[model samples]
Target chain A: MKKPIIITAALCLTGVILMGVLSGKDVEPGIVAKLKAKYSVKHAPSADHAGFEALKKKFTSPRQVTEACISCHNKRHKEVMRSSHWNWEREEYVEGRGVVYLGKKNAINNFCVSTPGNEGSCAKCHIGYGLDARGKGYTDQNNVDCLICHDNSETYAKAPDKAGAPEAALDLNAIAQSVGRPKRTNCGVCHFFGGGGNNVKHGDLEKALFEPDRDLDVHMASSGSNLQCVDCHTTKEHNISGKIYSLASMNQERSSCEQCHTAAPHGDSVLNEHTLKVACQTCHIPSYAKANATKMSWDWSTAGKLKDGKPYIEEDSMGNHAYMSIKGSFVWQKNVKPDYVWFNGTASHYLRGDKIEDTEKPLVLNPLHGSYADEDSKIIPVKIHTGNQPYDPVNKILIQPKLFSEKKGEGAYWKDFNWEAASRAGMKAAGLPFSGKVGFIKTAMYWPLNHMVAPKEASVKCGECHARSGGRLAGLNDFYMPGRDYSAAVEFVGKWLLLLSLFGVLAHGAGRILSARKHRNGENK
Target chain B: MKNIKEVLIYSGFERFWHWAQAGLILFLAFTGFEIHGAYSFLGFGDAVRYHNIAAYLLIVLIAFAIFWHLTTGEWRQYIPTTKNIAAQLEYYVFGIFRNAPHPTKKTALCKLNPLQKLTYFSLKVFLLPATLASGLLYMFYRYPEGGTTGSLTIETLRTTAVIHTACAFALAAFLITHLYLITTGKTVTANLKAMLTGFEDLEGTECEPEAEK
Candidate 1:
């Protein structure tokens, strides 16, 4: 008895020790502290641009500021000239369609259509000044707007309809003097206010990220790591590393979380294993459009409605635009749960004149190319922005409506509410045929969530995606998930087997009790 | 209790192995089902961690048990035979109601009846091996980069998980019947006491068949 007791105690001790050994050790606090310290370290400018003689002059035009910038940083303009920002397109090898130059210049989006006839307003986000309808001035080195990205003053902003020109009231001299590495403000100014409003295009890239708290974004939080956009999107030769798949087609020069945090950053091996096929953002970004509501759907068919012969705007309870005479009736969502898809970096786009295959279903503007079988693919969170935009039903092609122009009767849809006239002028500009009749076709655009990453504690829990019902990955049913899926036949058979065994044992026990009583009664008789 | 003879049936090491294996299997099943998403008790991360740890311990326990059975020549005790199997089944199904005698008798060398022998044999040879193999595959499904776990890759965990889950159900059913069968001894806890203390009281000294094998 003593030996057995002692052996059991020893076994128990062994189990306790095994638990300690098997639960993997966390990363060393000292190492994490060191990494955090290094991550948050801010860069000090090498030279004071304020003392530079070239920047001390009054700049008459935004183009003169670019001239002043190039006077000293002469070779920098050449690098900027070769960038995708200046060219507005990149030579990409599409999977099925060989080589094609795809970007804002020719790529047709569901929102605002394309940039061909709307370059006056669309080019406000462009890096160069005076980008005309043909995307000219890209060849000129002085057109590179240096202060737009490098402005540390956080006051530089492009005018609404100035063809990528800075606001007229901006003191260009002060802005050029304060120029340094790009901050969150520089990127967020255009990226956050995409699709003509704040938090409209990319649901995750929004105004809240300008000075995010740790709970909103761990990396960019001013009270936390306080990282600048340039820290992660490490730029070289004016070519930023991060690629937005909505406009990008190639797999090259894409920024990834693995660049900073290695692929296996978790202490537990199970989570590290998940990293093999699950993108970090799938779990990290629990929801997007955290601070403000984002545009979810746009119905352009309802755009022509006017109140008392005036193009007026209607707002929802959340103060988001419910209907705007220029754009359309809108659907806005806050704290939006992102849909997920398999993405392998490469993508294909619906170019300017591509014919629609099916008119009933929403046409995918930019289809990310990946599947379960793709080794490089991983499940990523995405915002699928759907719209009912104009298309030529007879030509079987989506129309690129001329959306923005300063003057009326220019065939701009916003100014002149005639879809036929707008479609004709827009197609003529894009060199595509458009029928006189116009129809609204449903369309979808995928914007992969890459920012506004929640803190470690706020990340998606395992149960959220691993449960049987209402799982985040429930739509992705092609593959099997552990907790969420199982063979129905197996479950049915297994359940019956367990139930029968229990019932059989109970019946047997009861029979034994009755048999004993019967035997005792027989003896008494 | 008078005129009853005390005999040692289960050895100390055998009893120790039995209880240890039982404890580990129960723990594994609890954690395994949690991982299968039947319920969430320990949380997924901790459940996976504990399951892997317990599985490793079970493997080690099994290795030691096999060694012990081989060294002590107790391996032959589980060699199944069809002889008297019908009579044993009949006794349980019908004859036991009339307080009938057991068709096969227990002894120190051959303690298990024919039905026990067959059940335990199948558990050790087929069900236990399948469960353990599938569990190990599930654990080491995807190896890290540059890992030398060569030529053992699997495309998916679906088949392995199904096999594992099915085996768990079978084992759980077997456990329920085995527990109830323990009460079918001479007294309610006769077999239980025998397993715990390695000693049991028999009716008569002559009942201890020296020529049982």
Candidate 2:
């Protein structure tokens, strides 16, 4: 009896809510599961292909779409022409792909530099909407023309709206034939698909959409919130004419993030007096959006093996891109110095200096969390030695990260029994030894050195950052001492080095002087 | 008093060794700071060169001083004692300001107060010994298994740097403490005078022969 009464009460409440919604009132959601169901397409665009055949059905060529796009967006077309995108397919005369059509013999693309025509179409992703796909017909018709997008086939006609070829939206009978896939699905078509032509850029296109506990595998399309193209795209800025800057517009900064995120994106205290400069992209990786990037790894011990007996790639339940991060670990042993570290991989679209060019020779990058780890199954050790910070790994020298930052330099070499033993003997033989804390004396930055800021992006480039041999982004500043210099053990090293050099120089100099005098005496005799 | 001058303020070799060792130690410190890239002195590279020379000179001077001290029985001056050691420490720390009488009086036969004995002894036995040994170890430091270390490990030579630095600061702190103690003498110039003239006048009559303590 109680159950029936409660059911009735719930039904009545739902009715009121439904009535309010019908009358245009905002409805508040309750923590209720009203038999929610999920839907998936039985089949999908190729993991190998981006369903470009559907695009081919709509437009004659990518060039036609470009032309239509230019017609609608005159101003944007001019800007696009100047952008890195326009330079994507470099054109020249007398090539087979050129208007005159020479054979496949003379194309100048990076992949097949001497091939013609289709080579332009093939390597189309080298620039521009290329960030979306190698050539997602962002070029073909030369107009922003696609049957799947904007229902262009309905409004702009196959043969210019003749009486016989009426648009499907207008004809009830043809509506069934023309009604196509939704807008969100079309957006994913490019967002998920990797690039093609010579270099396979972007990444694989057909990844599962809902990867719970794992990092998202989408590009400019990532967010904790499920967003439509217009949510971030906000206004249709008229600079692009009737074309309306949307997916095809490449140069626009995504001001949409500022609408919600309020965090100042940089390391704390990133300013000197009188400077209002900063960048958001310096630290935030595009696809790897989780707070910590280590979420995407797995315990290989339990994972099953592949046919080649290699472990099968398991999806990361956490956001860590173990595939990328493992390849980025740097260990400077006796000789290891890498040129660069690429924090992301084919999936990371906006991280500029991910490719840490030439730092690690025979650069080994495999697909774990996008880091530098060894092949097969070997562990590597990385010592996080801040160039100025010190620690004692032995005796009473507690080497915690906090110790280096705390005290001035007290525990730096306090437990280095070897150093203690060595310095003790020296002091016994000489005068006295002192002990104290050591700390960073005065550290400043050469702003344009290791980092750069352009409002939205920070370019932390290699070679550009680390610079020449022995030079550094964060150069050795002064040191603060609270105890013995060796308490921090940082200051004593140089004097010893100097003393050693002096002894060698003096020893040789004295020997030479004595030998010269002996020679003179022998001659006199 | 007439024969006091003939006892020799300090033996000729002892005086020479003291001045030379002090000069070399000071030179080592001056050049050490410049070499540490703290501030430019003789330029960075040259500072390193000079610091090395000074450090080696100190080592040699110290070597000679040790032999002299042992042979002439001067090493006994540094032998430590616990009698009145606590009182001597208190005299230097708190009593010195109050003008309280010293707990352990100094004399030609027993020059070091108990506190001074402990401190100076530690400098020699622990601090100074550690520094010298570390210096020698650092100078001779090289991988017995020669050839460049593989690219993934830190150089053993770098360890020397850390050890040497540890001792340098220890020595520096001692110098600062020593300077402060020097000022604690009866007059600002009194301790300096004793080392220079080897005579301390008493606050009592001329028969006492000490006008400063």
Candidate 3:
């Protein structure tokens, strides 16, 4: 009794000690301190600097404001002219296809089609003044719209089709006077509203980032790290790092978690080993569109359906647009789990004049290229935005349809509600042939999910990827995972061995018991 | 009744704890296999829910059993001994069919044979703890703050799952052998009746005092 009591007390004490050790405070603040030291720049020239005082003069056009600003910061416009954001064109060598010129300029995407004829609506996100390269030459010094990014007043609003000029009554002098470092609100003005509305293009980026709490994004959390967009996407001479796979040019520096944290950030060595095959975003960003619903799928075939001879709009259960007569039927989802894919940072786009070989499968407008065999490839999360768009039946190529118009009778699909006229005009403007035979073809575009990182405590659980069925990585047979992947032959042999052993034990025990019983009975007799 | 004697082999608390643990183990196995997608009688979600509840109940039962064993000094019964273990093995293998006598005698102070002591001790000390620890880790993998447990990657989670499953298989094997051994008592119903009534039929002679030591 005394021994048992002592042993029980020892066991309880051991458990208490183990708990205390495991709950000890962390000692490594080295990485966070290093990141803060390296990139934290002085809040870009405060408003009282002489550069802002010179901007107190009257300004009419955005170009006039740029000319005055360049008088003091002369090299700013030259730096802006070299970026892809200024030219709207990118050239890169894809694996199967030789060197190809691809960008929003000529590449056909599922959303908003090509930018050739739709530059007025698309160029609203462009940093420079004018629509595409038509209004101002690439070398034009006055075309650099500095206030678009530097405006702290947040009142500078650019109207579509006005040659990158703000609204009629807006105070350009106030915007010029308040120019300073850009904030999350500054970059989000155009990026968050991409693809015609909020949470449309990149499911991970939206208006919620403006004042996000820690749950939505730990880095951009108002009460946490509170990092700005440019913190990780560092810039040199107006050239920003971390271009998307669809827009990246050759020899560009890609932004990664290694910029702030070491490659092996986890304390556990086994977990650190997975960094080679898994992207940080795959685990960090558990889901996208946490703050709002994003468009998942669109069926353009359902568009142009009018109610009582007028365009109509219908809302789904979540109050997201289910159908719009001008656009199409859309399926919206919130807190969406991302699809996993292998990416090697290189992407191939289906540019205009590219042939459609397989009409049976949805046309891949922009396909990220990678495989498990590639050392450069890692399992990354992506959001697949699927839709149907107009294509030429006889020409066997996708046709861009003009969707928006400043006025009626301009062959815009929304105004005329005619696919044929819109296709002909859009194709003519894009310098592509139209066969007068139009049909809707299924198409898909992949958008990489790299934002809306949840706090580290909400990462995916073990069974989510390791279970035999209904696991996240169930069908990914390229790489071997222990619990998830097993050999049937090995299992069969193991089962047989267990069965044989059990049989031997049963037979031997039965023989011993029976013979003993017989001998005892004989002795008694 | 017929030159037979009955002795108190298992206490009432011991019998109750044994049966409760056995029932809980069976339920856990059923639900665990369903969650593993072996047969899927219950849907994945429902199987997970049932498995978690059964696991919690088993944990509570184990805690109570440990307390009872410590306070009553019954924990000493499972301390392993090599004495007569070879003889016990020989009896199972060859001597039993010849009507040879049992190598070791049972008493209230020494309730388990040498082989039972070792197997039960290992199950209690190693296999059961492994299963429970891995299971709890998997249950609370994600923290309330936002991410998973500190430094726990998906690979760590996968490794934990493998450990839990391997321990479960070991437990199943042990249970099967235990069930078969129960029928090998002096009479087929002797062991079952003892577990149910706390009294077991034994040979006419009293147990040796040295056997308890």
Candidate 4:
């Protein structure tokens, strides 16, 4: 009777499992087509600029191309003028400091120091033309380089040292006529090559992302979604959304993965619950700098060590610059695991003239603020770039060393190779007093990784962060995590209790067996 | 041998509950320890999923068993007594080895000895409840987004986890001792057979009906 019951139970169990498997495989018709229709790039321009009478004229200067663009779009120059890209500074209410205008103008970084003294070379990436130390170019509507962002020709190149002017060799009239919506090439030109070279600044962004595969970037994959920057960084009146925390202070106008994929995107309830405290990129973007090496460290103090008194570059086995006499020694890495941190979007910057209080630990250039107890805080992955930059020992402030110059003997660190002269010139340009004593202070900059999101299958496994030893979240100990955390005392007592019980049971059983054998032997006798 | 006779010590339902609960507890322990990262056998995700399912099943089993015990008035079997408790302890500790007679006689009316009653009572009342409650809390507790100061919410999983893990160890120890004690019956497999078939050999005692009030 029990044999038939057991067999029936096993059969029922198998039937339930098979039903579950078959149901999981069930998909709605046209689901793949629907997803493709929602995500595929369809950014063809509404109007052809080549047919426009305004753009047909021969343009000499990029400013003339701006004029042609303005004649048609008329009021767009005003919108661009009011943008942070045009002004290079925005009014922000920092936590400790009250309302203050902060941007690349006043903010100091460990790489290329600050933009004050090197405006001519640095402004090549700036949207406007003819930017100077005085920043008077902000008032000039004609200085806005429209073709750099809108040109479909993809041939519009900026002059290396012409204060944000177009390259002399470029056909401005053709580029002006070919103008269309901005593409990945437009943004990657400057953003991908930040900190003087490719993949040197933002570890997650680089030239490799121009035509990424699905494995490298699910959203921007050329064969997949093919999403452009503006798809997610939607703009209104020239003010772009999605601010980088390295430069941004306020939490306003930020883009998130939740903007498209809702907060509870995961099918699993437990995984969905994790979204309350964990950012999507923390798991999705498991490793960054997948295709190219990114700069991890730069020791500026080691600069000026020329190989035979001439600025020369030294390359490692991977051909990445290991040392440059003009800059310093650098440490580059690829496929790096990001350090996790609690971030709440809002950040505070170490301004150009801000005094350094703690010299023992590396100064955080832009401190991303959040804690476990904070309401808006979530665990986010960040690429921390560490370096040693020159500072004023007596003034207790970081020095904005003059890093670029056209002519020699202008106190440019690259040209003159003199820290004292570079600090003096750079500080003078920034309107700060130099104490004439230059010191290198270790500094760290946190760049939150947001792009190059891998496919869901490539995301971090539960064991990676939930394991007891060497977990990915081992650094974050502010809160208790299951599997990774337990009471040591309870564990010790519990282990011993189980061990002693087993020992006692074994000993008692052995005694019983021995006594039983002796009784059997006595009966035999 | 004083006329050994067959007696019903456990009802069919009672035996079913015992073995089902035993299977569930062993399965729970295996999955629970895996989820605690003791050793990765069934993977962490599967371990957690199976553990939670087993927990819900165990809770249902407990409810049914509770209802059965109350309706049958079989709950009186666990009313611990000091009578013959020391003698029972002595028999197990030393007398069993010398081939001495048993201290407490097993009958249908009173199936458990004093020491077994005390151990079973404490386990059913305290250890099991504490383990289940703490496990439930650990599974359900989630910090409110943006923070909360409500009494229902806990700031961390530390307390719930420690209690659950400690109870797990104690229960594991109980399982080892219980398995060994089953062999100490009239025969090596007597208790096992009785639990399976609902009958055991009892000598010098009236083999009353198991349901007799």
DockQ of each: 0.52, 0.03, 0.07, 0.40
User: For residues A1-525, could you state the per-residue lDDT of candidate 3 as single tens digits?
Assistant: 224434544554354335434533222357667765654544646345435656777777788888888998998888888777777776688778789777777777777777766677777777776664354545678878788888889898887766555667778887788777778888898889877789988998899999999999988888777898988888899887887765653435788876777666664333455567778888788899999999888888889999888899999998988999998999999999999888888877787988899887898877887777776778888899998988998889999887767877888888889999999889988889999998989999889889998887887654566577677766566765543554454445545655765886688676766776777788899
User: Which numbered prediction scores highest in TM-score against the true structure?
Assistant: 1
Give the DockQ-based CAPRI class for model 2. incorrect
Tens-place lDDT digits, model 1, residues A4-122: 65579477658755774656564324545766989866677899999999989887777888898878887999888888888888888888999998778888887777899988888
Window of ten residues with lowest summed lDDT in model 4 chain A: A20-29
Candidate 1 versus truth, CA RMSD in Å, comes to: 2.4
- lDDT for B18 in candidate 2 is 54
Native contacts retained by candidate 4: 0.44
The TM-scores that each candidate's chain B achieves against the reference are 0.91, 0.80, 0.89, 0.91
Cα lDDT, model 1, residue B3: 60
The predicted structure with the larger TM-score, 2 or 4, is 4
What's the true lDDT of residue A61 in model 3? 76
- Writing each residue's lDDT as its tens digit, candidate 2 over A1-525 gives 124334544553355335434433111122111111111113232232123333233433334444444554466554544332233322223212223211122211111112112222323222222222223433422333223232312332322212112233333222222333334443333333322110011112123332212243222233422333433344333111111111111223334223433232221111110011112232222222122221111121121223343322322344222221111111112111112222211111101112223322221111111232211111111111111111121221111111011122332111221233322332222232223221111101000001011122222222222222242222221221111123233435545555554564455445545655776688899
Candidate 4 lDDT over A1-525, as tens digits, reads 244334544553355345434433212335435556877647667888779888788887788888888888999999999888888888888899987898777778888888988999999888999998888777888999887788889999898978999889788878887888899999989999999999999998899989999998988898888988988899999998988877888889999887877675654556666777899899999999999999999999999987678899999877999999989999999999999999998999998788889988999999999988786899999999999999998999999988889878999988989999999999999999899999999999999999989887788888889898898999999988878888889889988998999999899999999998999999999
Give the CA lDDT, 0 to 100, for residue A137 in model 4: 72
Residue pairs whose backbone atoms clash in candidate 1: none
Tell how far residue B65 is off in model 1, in angstroms: 0.8
Considering the two chains of model 4, state its CAPRI-style docking category. Answer: acceptable
Error of 4 at B17 (Å): 2.6
Worst 10 residues of 3 chain B by lDDT: B142-151
